[model samples]
Target: MRISRRLRPRSLRTRLVLIATVLATSAVLVCQAAGLTVMRSWLTDQIDERLTDFRPPSPVYRDVADGNGLDHRARTDDVLPSDYRVFFYGANGRLLSESLGRSDGEPRLPHTAAALKLWNGRPTTVPAETGDGSWRVVADSGSDGMRAVVALPLDTVEGATSKLLWFSLAIGTVVAAAVMVLGSVAVRLGLRPLNRVEDTARRITHGELALSVTETSPDTEVGRLGIAFNTMLDQLRAALHRKDAFERRLRRFMADAGHELRTPLTSIQGFSELLLQQPAMAPLQRNEAHELIARNADRMSRLVDDLLMLAQIGDTPAIRRELVDLLSLAADGVTATALRHPDRDIRLVPLADEDTTPGELDVVEALGDPHQLAQVIGNLLANACTHTPSDTRIEVRVGTVRTGPRAGGTDRAGRTSAAGPMTPGIPASVIEVADDGPGLAADDAHQVFERFYRACHTGAVEAQPGSGLGLAIASTIAEAHGGRLELDTGTGEGCTFRLLVPETTAPKGHTR
Candidate 1:
């Protein structure tokens, strides 16, 4: 719920920005301090040097030589302002001469007896006031008892320093603020890739695997992370697809298996009902009930056998490049179906495409497992029959069906097709079992392959019959052999199931 929270906690941009801000602020502080220290020290050194270097004439002679305040003895005025106190002191406790400009009652120099005494013996610094409100005084010993005394103002110098300090502080503050702002921007920019990755990852969860691959690369660590994440998404998508298929098949298998087993149970119940209804009836009535029960039992047994065969076929491998005989598979399927459902018509016609026997005897051939193919055809036929009333037409015709037109994968012979089409250029070696029975519901086209998905609304079943897994099993088998099972929704009246098997150019081989 916290929208302001960071998506990438340890982001590169944030770290770099923080580091830059710290260094920038530190540099500003150091430079400002150094500048202020150097300026203050240099000013202090000049003032002290001036105090030490000044030499004055004798008090009487200095006053007489300069002619009151206009003399060159006031040369210190040219260097500093007249507001400062410039005077001469004797080591013999004599106040030689003083240039007291604008001092009415008392001189700006500290002329108190205690200060003068200290000033005479020791060249000292003291509190003094000149034309300005107040200043500090420095008196230095000179040779021949002519000491120089200079009064420097605390107020003026401090005012200048205070202004300088303020400016420096302002500049430093601005610099620090700028550093922080720029750091934040740079952090966002640098972490932009990570944001992209986050967004792409979010999209991938919504079934957009193609959204994230370009966000990061495998070159840098971040790129590597991106690649790994994308790969994981791909694997997850595949897994989910397989899981859905599995659930669908599982449900169909359970439904069909359960439905197929119902006959025996119903027959058992029916026989029990009859026996109860006619306990003292004729012996013929009992015999007829027994016969009906046996017939139902036989039907149930065959259904179980078919279910088991289909399940077994699903488990077997159907290699794409392996050889198989279409004729033999079709013949066997036809014979089994004819025997199993004697009341219904089942036929298999090996309709060769070219019609002429090329390279001896031209028979339908392809790459597949014979057992799975048998199951595929048998299940298709059985499905057609199950949906139709008895005596409905059901035929499976196999031949060299064409597959092309759409471009696709590279074959060893350099042939390609498009769209990964099952029925590509021409009619693929297809076997279609269609009937005039109640066709598929428009909605059931997609769901017929789903497990246990009986069309309860259609009223097709006396009860839910036929494990829905049959078509699913057949479809899987077909795909394993580079073939596909397609349902032709021929209106809602009937659905035609087509098995498109890829026929190879391999020479005709003898079938045992």
Candidate 2:
């Protein structure tokens, strides 16, 4: 088995060439054998026909009957070839007189009754009278009561057949060699594309990830193979790019998280050390230090909680799904924000296309985790309230917008269409939290949903700095529920955050 495997052709081109050569050689050999057989048969038949047609003169027969032997100078000798022989036999099947062909000595003759019977009246092959070679002979009884045998030597026929056999073998050898050589060349040309594929693979192994197969015709086997290879390469490159981006984002997130945690830890450590060293300090100063430490601790705790929540949302699809009313969630967020910042004008407003007033807005319902959606609304409201001045007016609007395949046109608030809905043409619920405040800069706007990203306001002072994870957590939760959190904002024009989720479609005559 090992030897056979080692002897087998390893390359595709070599195997193809070898197979073609073998088939051609086989065909040539079969033709050679067939030609040899037919030629030998035809030559032997001609020799038999000549022996049967030839007849000796009367003198030769008469002399042979009288035991005078054959007449060498008979006129019939000129009509017959020198290789023909005549033998005279008695009635008792005893050889009496004979004529030798060109060969010396007496030729082998069939003298016995059984031999004469077998060779009578038809040509048959038998050993020569000289016991040297074979002859084609016929036996017959003459009218003079004498029996005669005529024979022909087979040397000429065999000699011609031998020459033809040798010629055919020579021709077959040349044909096989030409087939091998030409077949090898044809196979090499046919496999050129495969050779290119091999070279491309070698280069890719050496780290050329951007390379793609260019012979994508789809008309031949090799062309189709090239097309598949190109597709696989494209997908591989895309996956690698995504992996690289994810790694970079993770590294940045780690660094920012460490920095955020370190700040609060440092403040807590400093305040505890102060209390330890100054036990007799003034009550007011000590109380202020305690308050500062508590505030920092609370910020650190909230940051940790937000980080945990983001991780959960990113790593799993285990959100508690239920039908959620976006209008009610927005109203609740407005009430909570108003209590937190009573100086700010925070209200729930109707969208431009809503037929009813703000207080009677439609129940914009969707399928999602209620707690997570509520958190998203609360975070958007809190983000607006924290970033802008106390006099800024914040508006929360809720409505259903067309989404999904064939979804087009603007929403009620004159915004571009979102993605298609859960059920083909059904609309998706959207909650927009808009604030007329000092909006984020163009650069900061893009990275607002990134972990630990905080925008700086130039002309306003915040009542308290946040942990910078509210928007990030909100985005993560929205994605986990198969929804998206999009922001529409510009410098000085204020900011608006849109939360769009797939709406639940109920059966006709039923409400969800």
Winner by TM-score: 2
| lDDT score, candidate 1, position 186 | 76
Report lDDT (CA) for all predictions.
0.61, 0.75
Candidate 1, residue 87: lDDT: 62
Each candidate structure's TM-score, on Cα atoms with residue i matched to residue i, is 0.48, 0.81
Candidate 2 stretches greater than 4 Å from native: 51-81, 85-151, 179-193, 354-359, 404-426, 458-461, 507-512
Scored by lDDT, model 1 comes in at 0.61
Q: Per-residue CA lDDT of candidate 1, range 201-220, in tens?
A: 78877876556467556667
Instruction: Return the TM-score for candidate 1, rounded to 2 decimals.
Output: 0.48
The clash count of every prediction, one per candidate, is 25, 9
Q: Tell me how far the alpha carbon of residue 194 in candidate 1 is from the true structure, in angstroms, after superposition.
A: 13
